[model samples]
Target: MLDYLKKSFARKKARRQFQEYSHTVSKFILKEEGEIAFANWNNPLVTPKVISQEEVNFFKKFIPKGALCIDIGTNIGDTTVPMALAAGKTGTTIGFDPNPHVYKILEENVKLNRDKTNIAPFPYAITKDEGEFYYHSSEASFGNGGISNEIVSDQGAFQLPQKITGINLEKFLEKNYRALLPKLSFIKVDVEGADKEVIGSIGNLLTKYKPVLVAECFTRATSEERAELYNIVADLDYTLYYFSDFDENAEIIKLEGPKDMNRWKTFNFYAIANAE
Candidate 1:
């Protein structure tokens, strides 16, 4: 009973800290091999240097110059900026984020690096179809935002449901990026728990471009949903590799099959197209 009370107190204290940080905004210079200017509220734990340096290194090694890339769930341009830089001036990095509040930050961050990187920010959510949906934007944790049809965080003290525009990936790509499809080199997805939906919507694009795909899978998805995601990649003739970190030397464990992911609650993975 005494230990339980201590644990409860600790949780309450952590919650208080989260609330405090949520209302605070600050700017910092994020430095890894390169430097990025960043600002954030409610996300003291995130910075370009810490979470994305390894990813940047990995992209530098794999993504060719002048490549076209996509960044889904581009929160404040942390990953987008690095990818844009890696893509060089001739290349373009398109980013999507539906949360209005955070999308503003994403825009600002993109502008902050405008002179150095080629990044375009889109204020729309990627879904299986075009429509409007309620976005659950969490106040305490900014990254927990998700569409009404998808799973979102329930741990926050407060959340606002804001109606946002959703874009069908296939249709949008056809209309806007069709000409660049051949140059598409990489696609990064981190749409909370809705990765499967996004991947499903872009089946044709994946088949045509066969860009390297990096996606985040949440443990909250059902076993069937997980299987569907794995099958989708497999059907595309892509080999699966689990991403252990952003480090250039991060472990890239190849999975023989989808069952290999059953035990992890959340994991990042890479899907590389098999040679034709």
Candidate 2:
């Protein structure tokens, strides 16, 4: 009876915490310009700290008007919306988020901007192979949710585990998006620590379409893992550029070597297939 009471108390506390977080998120959203909705109240992206204005400007500069783009980790349409708007009516933007909990919000955000942004949201995790995988749902922050393939214990909030479908990027593209492959212009990938796997899965497409890739490189990744990821893009003859901070006027430094990158906990960088 005592144990039961303890569990009940814990549950109540958690509920209260969640409620407070939700209210804070709502307040934050009210200040934003766009009609952005979030399924998870604790989603880090809901806070302005997560989305930087410079990052938005960088994406806008690269993702041309009327271009087909892919947002690997849409995260409630923060970057996806801008990509869609930049793509314009003649272009298409496909956003993917495996987290079912947050996917609903992604869909809602896309719908909210339907008239202005041509963005499609898919709730499937992209992987090197097509199969089932456990996705660690983070109770603390939406940004921390990641695949179970690698032991990601640091997933914030550490919520219940969920089984998510992993789609093979190459196969999915060939089967359904083959016609749109050649038209692919940009791909923004921010799949937590699964950056290598995500990039590897789309190796063929990277070579064929040569779309500009914007990937998040987590400092937690081992030097070897980073090297392999760098080689993957380098082998395909892509030039690397790094965005060390959120300064809009900051120059996108050309990464000549691995040592060039500022080892921030998580940093966004770009890889252009063909560069002068």
In model 2, how large is the Cα lDDT of residue 10? 54
The TM-score leader among the candidates is: 1
Best by lDDT: 1
Which pairs of residues have clashing backbones in candidate 2?
Answer: 140-157
Candidate 2, residues 1-276, lDDT tens digits: the string is 999887666555553343223322221232222443323334333444344444445566767767789999776666786677667667889989887656766776665545556877788889887777766644433434787655466654454345778888778767877777778889989888788788888988888888999898776787777777777778778998887643457657787866654455567788988754
lDDT of 2 at 264: 51
| Candidate 1 Cα misplacement greater than 4 A, ranges | 1-34, 42-53, 137-142, 149-161
Query: How does residue 115 of candidate 1 score in lDDT?
Result: 58
Candidate 1 local lDDT, residue 5: 87
How accurate locally, in lDDT, is each candidate? 0.73, 0.69
